[model samples]
Target: MNNPYNVLCIGVNHVPVRRLSKLDYAEKDAKTVAKYFDTLKDKAHVTLLTGENATRTNVLNWVKQCSNIQGKLTVIIFFAGHGSAEKDENNKKLERCLWINSNLDTGPGSHQLKTSEILNLLNNPLHQLIFLIDACYNFDPKQEVSIQDIFKQFKESERMTGLKQYAIISASAVNQGALEDPQLGHGVLTYYFLQTMAGKYTFFLRRKISFFRFLAVLDKRVRNHRFLTDT
Candidate 1:
């Protein structure tokens, strides 16, 4: 556990709300994410948080307690759940980062966690942090409550301060859906990332492999997959 880099994979397969639509591939998604870290078990401390039983308390604990204080701590947050966007009174937009146990039917600030709140957790001086979001907001154009609508109201630049060497990598681009497949048992983007990193894929520039190049490999694989559901 003294390796300096600690990777915690939090994959929630269960939602809090009963009778709600469930993710058909949550278990597979969670398992795949865990497996990815299992490969790094020899070099770094790896923790896997999976299943519908995962709670926010455990997540916060892992981030706050398990982080390496002395060395280069690379913390990665991977969520494969629902996400939304909400607006403030001054028409400011905010990214409503939902946990697996989130209650989407509730009013603003009810069951969801703001992206800012999560960012605040990582404000402390750490080695480094990376957030990978595999969730997308469902926007109904006619309702004027588009996901992009809420995000347009706020400036990410301001909120992104104090996050030293932090990078946010999302699964979907602008106005794109986060694709999932039952057969693959994971999100398309995550699956491809694992495949690319399967064999000692370099995570740092010192290894002469940029993250951009790593992603290109994933993008190519996803594009060639005939069963991909994303548009």
Candidate 2:
């Protein structure tokens, strides 16, 4: 089926590193999200990149190719994994990045992709872009600066570009962990997001819910339930 929109769902469940613990349900989260978009096969072209296939090279290549397509296109990227940021030599915050692979080193060969890189790659070719990040912002507790503050800084950098039609929904607030629910077998944010998308909440059943609306509902659900910290 031909769809006007393209969706890229990337999930990193297992990072092959001894220092990094495995996200057992991340693959499940990715698959579930991909399937949810697959249901909209008539309206969107969905692609799933997970596990070993979600390397930095592969993900960037896909973004570059998507940018070259000529049309009024809406591209959505959903990532569920570990999110990290490194301090510059002067102790300033660098860009928050997604760990696409198991490499924990902060180097060129680490297989990490920065949010800025994604934006730069997708610039000027798509009609709209959305980022759904289900990961922790500051995994290090000694950083002193809060994740919310870091996010604000990130947004300020983005605003300088003057791109207006994009939205970013991250799972947690400052210093809060993006938790997971073991009983539910999914990430806390991912579970609620899918639940809303599936119309499991009756109030949203008949409405064309916007991303902001979904996030509002999700925040409520998360606050009401007990979720385990992502360790």
lDDT by residue for model 2 (1-231), tens: 135768888999777644557887777888898887777577778888899888887788778877887778878788898776645435466556777773345554275677878888888544578777777665455556665657766654331122486667666533345666788898877888788777744222234756556657766776666433422
Residue pairs whose backbone atoms clash in candidate 2:
none
Highest-lDDT candidate? 2
Compare the candidates by TM-score and give the number of the best one.
2
Runs of candidate 2 exceeding 4 Å displacement: 88-91, 102-109, 139-163, 200-207, 226-231
TM-score versus the correct structure, for each prediction: 0.74, 0.79
| Candidate 1 residue lDDT tens string, 1-231 | 555456666565556544335666655666677666666566667676666345566666676664425555666666676555544446455445555553235544444556566666665464577666666544334345654554564344221122346766665543445667766667776776676776455553224476666656655676676344433
When summed lDDT is taken over every stretch of 10 residues in candidate 2, the lowest stretch is 154-163
